[model samples]
Target: MNEIGGWRLSKKLGSGGNGIVRLAQKGEQKGAMKILRYDSPKARNRFHDEVMSMRLCADIPGVLPVLESQVDPDEPGQKWFVMGLVKLLTDQLSDRSGLRTVVQAFAAYAETLAAMHQLKVSHRDIKPDNLFFYDGGWAVGDFGLATFQGKKAVTGGGRKIGPIYYLAPEMLNDPGNADERCADVFSLAKSLWVIATGQHYPLPGSYDLDHSAFRIGSYLSGERGVIELDRLIASATAFEPSRRPSMKLVGEELRAWLAPNVEISMPTNIDFKEHIAAIEQWQHSRARAAKSQKVRDEAIRSLTNRLSDYLNSPLSNLKNLIEKSLGITTTINKNPKCGFLELRVEVPADQDRLAFIILILDLNCESFPAVNLQGRIILEWRNKAGFINLIWKRCYEFIENGADEPIKIDTLRAEMTEATLKALSETLSLIIPSHKIEHKPKLVRIKVHDEKGDMLSGVSLRFIDSEGITLAAAKTANGIVEVALPTLKNVVIFVAHGSFNSTVVTLPDENLLVVLNGDPRSRSMICGGSWVSLAGLKGELAFVHDEIEGGIHRLYVHLKELSGNSGAPGAVDLSIGKPVRLKDNAGRVAYMTPRAVIGDNYLIDFEHAGDL
Candidate 1:
């Protein structure tokens, strides 16, 4: 072992951007020392800056501290600084770890980052390797890419200086000019998602392709408050910096989950922290975009894997609670290889065989995300035994409140319990003495296609009566779905995909093509008879922003009637950037807000503000 500054260097730990890290022991004390590689003045000064930055955060709980350092450049062969040794967080937890462990790590990471942001220091390069679990808490390490207030920028052109997987888009595009604090927020949020989910990288936006059964929220949902972590993560990792929440707010929300009522119990005896150490060598960069296809390959695990420990999971607790409270034993079957969370429950029977109920929740892969998580709450069972089965289910979505919110356990349980009771009550009311009659069911296979004649899958289609009473509903798979139609009464078929306008058709149109060719909206406006028409229609309609007098309120869209749509003559002014509603003499009937603009128009998008 070679001695440097009275410390004997032991095993090589890893390499960092600035230098090589090694385990150094001096008089029974061990720590990590990063030795500067290049001897240039710029390199020495940069290393000195790193040392000073750590020193600034010396006493912070979750920050790795700089202890002894050889800062004098004139008398040193190589610059080096010793930091207190810490075990990597990745070494403690892994792909199959419990969420409680992640929350434990997150609370520390959040608190530390909040403090750093307060001091104007940003740990821009955040990833699994740089995070450490030590001193009874988690700490963020490696400030190689950190930038503090008044720090001189020396970014090379066309070179990105942050961790490749976690770096914000803004940093990758313009690293020198990007906001450090905002970059820290994105990277930290990404890092947390990676730690919670043992995935290589986070998916874009809130569209998590992970199985609902194994997601972080799924692990903690049962009887717990809404963590809304998916939404939170999405907001922080938004492409725009203005959309990200402040680090302080992030810390507050994370710390809120640590409260007593919301504490999620550890479901297993396997403590992730006690696992064997697998120290990985850190890399400076890789491709910016992660291979999301690889994630698809590692999709849902078999249900047999859940035959044992899954009973201890939070979701299992919820299932047991529902069954016990209802005095009903739910008969459920699962195929381990399938990605759907389909459950069918048999309810209590009525006197004289007059009633029955079935509770079902269908979470298939195709119809997911667009509608998020959808399930029915109530249905009337039509059995020939004159037995009225009341299904306690209506169209309720667990994620309607927030697109990214997972099925929170408390919410799911409450809805289910209410649905079961309501369904029972409905069944009793509809019960009557009648003869038993059973007939073969009917299913009409209808294929759906888009305007261009391409097959459209996952579109939710509803079969209805003339009175707008829904008879049956189903989603199209492989561009086709079989829906049962009524034999006696006349019915119509319609498809409503999420919130978009549906492709409506009556019976006999089995091959449905989604032809949104003509502007039906325009036709509807014309047929309304009473509406607002443009004053003095001209050659070109230009919808642009109005920056006059501080924009005269944000919702103001300045409309101009130009001589030509492209090459502009003097713009003939129509309206200023102000909210305007066109009255049809039917009070509070119509309003206009720019949805999207065509051509090279300076469009201003706004919500309800100052009304005119």
Candidate 2:
């Protein structure tokens, strides 16, 4: 039996610690598929979480969609997920200076992180590889390592589970007690540093060092580039959890730095890292696109063979003999053998010459099951003498029951040759009238000439209109029509001729939508994370980074709002010129002297700083 689903697997794309990816397709839909190594509890749980988180963030432009997710009932330990295929940036971190591109790629990620934090959630792990781009936008992916703040992780056992290179100093010192949200900020900062510098953070073995020691040594040593970012990383990755800024603040700070220097022409919507990781995540989606293309190619080849056979047939000349004596033009129209069989013959100005014909062949063609043996078409024209005749024979089989063997090479070559002969013979039977035929104006025109090749005039067209309403429409002398639209937004046009329809759509603005007309498998984008604090403020500026069993952490104070003049309960318009430190979620302290000028409009409300 033939395969019910139209697909053929192509090749393997990639594999990783969790699963292997392959290219695949269903009908015309091409994408990638990921099959897990085993559906262990950990795998299944992670898979479930990934699907859920991806679905929640589906509106984010760069993130690929999860087409389907299935678990093997029998194996119980086998699972699979389908994802959109994307092109990947090859090892950009170790190679080129793509900081501008990197920022563009992670713009969407920043928005996502900010939104997530607003909802009181923490990704827990943020790194370069977990970001991806799709349709020119960025998204944060790999929620497998994510831990929602204020609550115990969905999966128990507090191991230092994130990538070591992006780990915060606090997580390195004591993994178990490290605050999830604060640690996420440090990791995000580390990622930014890598993208900006194309190198790892200052401390190479920081993940293995004591948190307290690494923080003091790395920050004071000044190994990382750009003094400002180095200091920001140091404060965000401080050994003490209380010293780290919130993810929201980190996003703000990163935006502040990038906004003034907007030299990046990239879309602020896509993530490129996620695209790379997705290639590492799912390979099946790629296979699907290949399979769909193969089917279409095969079908087209079959039609071409049939046409060639009719054109080369020896009996083709008989069609011309009948049309000349009748003093009329004959045109034969028939459906190809692919779908359904239809034959229509039109003779201008002669009722007897017109024919609506259908032909059926009883012979069993064993190879082509898609062809219908019971249906075929033939059109013939004859004069009063009836001795000399014009005949056109065309075959279209809509239903065929035959052997399911692959078509033989010899048979195809022979049939194709015969089809070519028949097509030529039939074309000669049609006689053009003295008047030329025009189909439309300023679009597509169907023209005709007489036996002497003299162009005919006063010929009108019968075709479909813009609304698909068929009518006797005429063309201008230039053979064109002005078909305007209701509005500029409706820039797309679709033309349908009988059974087939061709559509043309105008490209929308970049922010609106992107059409994937070609293979999406070879396309991809980079991914990155967002910062919480723009100016590196931590400790007292806390607004419930996450909920813990006992209480909240990443605490800070709003010094500007607290009235220090008379030691009374009052509020002050928080400013950013002087450095401020939030201490123990209980009070605020001066980190820098009043003489240190940062900027104005920096709201460090002593009472309302932790409003988040």
lDDT digits (tens) for residues 1-612 of candidate 2: 121124334678777667767787777876677676655666666656655665565665444688776643334434777777655432432344344455445445656776665544457668877766545556566565654433322544455557788876656546655556667777776676566554444354322222332322232222211333434555455555655555544544445444543346775866554344234223323322343556546654565456435433322343354356554343333444322222233343133432222221222332222232322233222211111111222223221111111122234334533543453334333322333433323333333233344443332222322222333334323323333222222122222111111112222111221121111111111101211221223321211121223221111223333323334332222211212333332443323211100011011112212222
For this target, which candidate reaches the highest TM-score against the unseen true structure? 1
Clashes of 1: 11
RMSD of 1: 22.7
Q: List runs of model 2 lying over 4 Å from the truth.
A: 1-9, 60-64, 71-78, 88-98, 149-158, 172-177, 200-202, 205-225, 261-612
Clashes of each: 11, 98
Worst 10 residues of 1 by lDDT: 276-285
**lDDT, candidates in the order shown:** 0.52, 0.40
| lDDT of candidate 1 over 1-612, digit per residue (tens) | 387899899889999667988999889889998999777876776787777777777777799988789966667466798988999998878755666668668768888987886666887888788899877778888887777754443567667768887788888767766677777888888887876666777654432313242234443323132234654565577677756766765665566555545445877866443221111000101211243655323331222232223322433554576578766555444432221333344444343221234444434322211122223332222222111111232233222123222324345555765665565554433333133323344556777665667665676655654333557768778777876665313344545442123334433333445432222121111001122233223222333323234212121222233222222344323221112333322221222323211111221212211111
